[model samples]
Each structure stands twice: as structure tokens, then as C-alpha cells.
Target: MLYFDHSASTPIHPAVLKLMQDTELNHFGNPSSAHQFGQKSRLVIEIARKQMAQAIGCLSSEIIFTGGGTEANNLVLWNLLHQQKKHVITSAIEHPSVLNVLKQLKEFGVTFTIIPVDHACRVNPEDIQNAITKNTGLISIMFANNEVGTVQPIERIGKIAEQHGIPFHSDAVQILGKIPINISDQKITMVSFSAHKFYGPKGVGVLYLKKGTNPKSLVIGGGQERNLRAGTENTSCIAGLGLASELANKNIAKRKTHLEQLADQFKLEMTDAYPEIIYNGHPEHSLPGVISATFPAVTSNILIIKLDLQGIAVSSGSACSSGSVNTSHVLRAMNMSNDHNIRTLRISFGRDNSKEDVHLLTEKISEILKQHHNKR
Candidate 1:
């Protein structure tokens, strides 16, 4: 199948896959054990952590391993409960991980302000500034939206958070490999990443907590991840993540250019075929490979199945809420109509995609639209 869902998860790179397999087969000892095998496993995890830190320009000691992006996001947001000020400032277009955690925090008497985004799904930095209160202890914003692929003004937001002495956290799951990240330059206090989103193995993620920012430990067991996160590490997956980080750091520019070419080719062909087609997300400040296209008369659910039968893999929105009947909260927050929301399809390109893949996708979409019109 032609996979166009890179935002959900990327296919593991061959090199990363090989490393993971080798590590899993040869180094199966628990990292907590004091034996030679355990020490080797420990080394593997540290190397991965260091690679991730280097990729984002942070200290190796600042990284914490977690189950995935959700856990990573939770680790930061949930820690607000232990703070003297329990209020957070975030955008309305955050992933379910952030939104859901914030929602649940409400029950614990921790209030939050969800600043609204504009029609382009871009959060206004001024709105976030206005929403911040004296009690606002944290500002959690996503680096790039998962559904619409709109890159937020995180650097500005980080500055605002800094001015107010609030910790800034970004759900950077979609931005890691696609964008060049400099944690210190951005002034972000914390950022989260899932290895699978960057062509590494699944079930592994990283939370980059800036030095001098201490959130309460989310998991308390043995002394792992500097007592911030506990439990045995997934050594093989961590190795894969390290390799993926190294690859990303080396090829960020190359990958960005390629994906932009693909996205440009796609839009040119798609707009030529359907002039009324609507593209969501910021046209200027957006992820290169991700596209959110809305077809006015088409039902995305039906189109998704039809495309699937033709071996074209796409998604209606976030993979987590794929089959749900409810429309996307991201689109809704941007004031997208219910009709347009239902008609929207998220087509995300990855390193594996090519010009040929774009041609096939647009051709199939045209063919399907023609069939639907003819039937009607």
C-alpha cells in the first residue's frame, strides 16, 4: 500500500531496523542489573539519549525516555498538579494527549486556558499572552499540529512564558525529524518526541526537559532516567531511536527539500484537477510533507475506504481518532464548518514517498471524484 500517513507514524528506516534487531537479539539484559550485560544495555540507552539531545541541542542528562508521545506529554502536564500554581496556557489545536490531560486536570482543580487559533489554524502569540494569568505556571503548545500541520509560533510563545517565569512545553512529536530544533534558541523548557514519528521503532519516546526545570516524577520505581521516569528501558528501541536521531540531524535539510518538492507537486496537480479544493494549515509556516485537503462535496469517510481499496493509504485526521464519527477538534477550533471538516483528508508525505506516489494519489482522487459525480 502507498502509505501517506507519516504524521501518525513513519516506516522504520532500514538502518534503524537493523540496529534494533541486533540490539534485541544480542543485548537482552535488564538495564537495572549490575552485570556486564546490564551495563552494556545501560550504555545503549545512554547513547540513544545523547544522540537525541545532540539532535535538539540539549544536554544528554535532560532527556527522559517514556512509552510514547502521550506519556511524554503527560509527564509534563501532570506535574502541574504538584505546583503551587496549577494553571496552564495552551492552544485549542493541541493533540488529544495535551487536550485530554488538560481536561482531566480540571477535575483536580487545575484550571487551564485554551487560546483559540485563527482560521489558518495558527495560534496568535498575543492571544496566548493575553490568556496567561498570574497563576499560570506552564504554557504547553504543540510545535506543529498533527492534523493540519500548522507550525505554531513556539519561539515567541517560549519568550512569553519566560517573561512570566512559566515553563514552556511543546508536543513536538510531528516536528522532530521534519524541522531543525534548537532547544536553547527556542527557549522552550520541555519538548516531547516519539521515535516512530521520526523513522525509529515504535513504543519508545523522549521527553526533553530543560536543565533547572524540575517537574515531579511521573513514575517512581527504581532509579532510571535520573529518578524522573522509572521502569526498565526498551534497549533495542532506544538504540533505533538514537540511530534515527543521528540520521535526522545529518539529513534535515535534504529531507526538508525533498518533502517540500513532493508537497509542491501534489498541490499543483490537485489544484489543477479541482479548483474548488481547500487546503488547511498555514501556507507559509507549515510542515513540508503534511497536507490537509478538503473536498467540498466529498465525504472523507467514504473516500477513505474507496482509496484504501485502491491501495492508497490516507487518513481523515489524527490516526488516534480515525474511525470516530466526531469531526476533528483541530478543524473545529479553527472555525472550519462541519461539512468541510467531514470532507477533509490528511495526506502526509514521508521520505519513502516520491513524485510517482503523488501522481498516483492525485490520479486516483480524480478518478474517484469522477465516479462519484457520474453516479450522482
Candidate 2:
């Protein structure tokens, strides 16, 4: 089956998988133990930490491993609970993990302003600046949107936050492997990433906290993850993530060029079949592999099923919100018409996809549309 849903999750790299298996077989000891076995596991965790840190260009001590991006996001936002009567600035297009946590923080007297995005699904840095108030303590925005793949002006926003002395956080889950990242260069205070998004095993994530930025720990019992995250480290998964980060960092430019070419080919091929197709998100500033479009007269749900039956895999929107009767919050924020919203499709390419896959996808789509028109 052709998998075009890389935004949802990626197939683990074969090398990463093999390393995970080997790590599990060779080093299956508690990292907290003082014995040699545990020391070996501890060394494994530290090495992985250094690998992840080097990939993102951050200090090794600043890297904290979490269960996933969701947890890493929660860990960052949860710090707001300690401050009363605080306000936060975030974009309307953030992942639910960040938005939902801010919602819960409301009960504890933390208010947040959601800056709306433009039609291209991009957050204006000026809007974030305007939303900032004396009570503003943090600003959280995704580096790139998951559904529409719009890359926000995070560096500009980070500069604004730095000027205002507000802590800035970015959910970099979607952009981690697809883009070159230097956490040290950006004024960002914290960043969240999931390994699975970058051809690594699931259940492994990283949080990059800038030096001197300490968020409250969500898990507190034993002294694990430098007293930030407490649990037996997932050594095998961490090893896999370390290798994945290294590979992605090494080949980012090459992978990005490949994915962008595929995306361009898909759009060019689909243009003739559906002249009325509305390409969503920014034309130039968006992620290379993610293509969000609205095909006129075609409901996304039906189109998804048709594509799946034809051995093609795509998504209506974010995997988390799929199957819900509700439409995408990102589309709504961009002021998309309800009709257009229902017709939207998000196709994300990955390292394994190719020009042939793009051609076949367009052919299948053309066939589906022709059959659909004939039926009508």
C-alpha cells in the first residue's frame, strides 16, 4: 500500500529498528541501579541524549526525554500552573496537546490569547506581539502546522518574546526531521519533538530547554532525566531516536529536496484533473512534503475511502482529529468555508515515497474523479 500519511506517523527506519532490537537484547537493565548493568544502560541513555542534543544544536544537559511530544508539550505548559494570574500567547493552529493544556490551566487562573492565522495558515508575529500583556508569561506556537504544514514565523515571534521577557515554546514535532533546526540560534526557550515523526520508534520524544529555563516537572518521584522526567528510561527507544536524529540531521537537505519535488509533481499532475482544486497553506513558506488541498465537489471522507480502497493512503486532516464529526480547527482558523473544509485533504510524503508514488497517486485521483463524475 502507498502510505501518504507521514504526518500522522512514519515507518521506522530499518537501521533504527535493528539498533533498537540490539539495544533491547544487549542492555536490559534499570538505569537507576548502581551496578555495572545499570551503569551500562545509563551510559546508553546519556549517549542518546548527546546524540539528540547534537542534532538540534543544543547543550546535552538541556535535552530531556519524554514519552512523546504530547508529554513534552504538557511538561512545558504545566509550568504555568505555578504562576497565578498569568496570560499566555499562542496561535490558533497549535496541536491539541498545547491548546488543551492551556484550557485546563484556566481553572488555575492562567489565561491565554490565541492569535489567529491568515488564510495561508500562518501566524503573524505582529499579532502575537499585540496579544502580549503585562500578565503574559509564555508564548507557545508550533514551528510548522501538522495538518496544513504552514511554517510560522517562529524566529520573529521568539524575538518578540525575548524582548518581552516571556518564555517562548515551540511544538517542533512536524518540522523536526524535515527541517534543519538550531535551538541555540533561535530565541526559543523550549521545543518539543516526537521521534516517530522522523522514522524513529514510537514512544520516544525529546524536549529541548534552553539553559536557565526550568519548567516544572510533571513526573516527580525518582531522580530520572535529571529530576525532570521520572521513570525507567526506554533505552532501546532512546537509542533508536538518537540514531534517527543523527541520520535526519545528516540528510535533511537531501530529503527536503526529494520531498519538495514529489509535492510539486503531485500538484502539477492534479492541476489538469481538478482545475478547481484549492491548494491550502502557504505556497512558498510551507513544509515541502505536506500538501493540503480542497478538491471541489469531492468530500474528503469519501475521497479518503476511495483512495484507501485503491491502495493509496491519505488523511482528511490531523490524525488526532480524524473521524470526528467536527472539521479541522486549523482550517476554521483560516476562515475556510464549511464546504471547502469538508473537501480538504492533507497528503504528506516521506523519505520512502518517490516520483513514481506521486505519479501513481495522481493517476488514482484522476481515475476516482472520472468514475465519480460518470456516476453523477
Measured on C-alpha atoms, candidate 2 has an lDDT of 0.90
lDDT of 2 by residue, 1-376 (tens): 9999999999999999999999999889999999999999889889889999999999999999999999999998888877753798888999999998889988988898999999999988988888988888889999999999999898898899899888899999998778888888899999999999999999989999888876777987888887898878999999999998998887789989999999989999999778888899998888989999998677988889999998899999988775689989999999998999999999999999989989999998888778877888
Candidate 2, residue 354: lDDT: 83
Model 1 C-alpha lDDT per residue in residues 1-376, reported as the tens digit of each score: 8999999899999999999999999889999999999999999999998999899899998898888899999999989889899989888888888998889989999999889999989989999888988898899999999998999998888888889888999999998778898887988989999999999989999999888877778888878888887788889999999999889877789989999999999989989989899999998999989999998578888889999998989998899775677999999998998999999999999998989999999999988888888888
lDDT of 1 at 202: 92
lDDT of each: 0.90, 0.90
| TM-score of each predicted structure versus truth | 0.98, 0.98
> Which pairs clash (backbone N, Cα, C closer than 3 Å) in model 1?
none
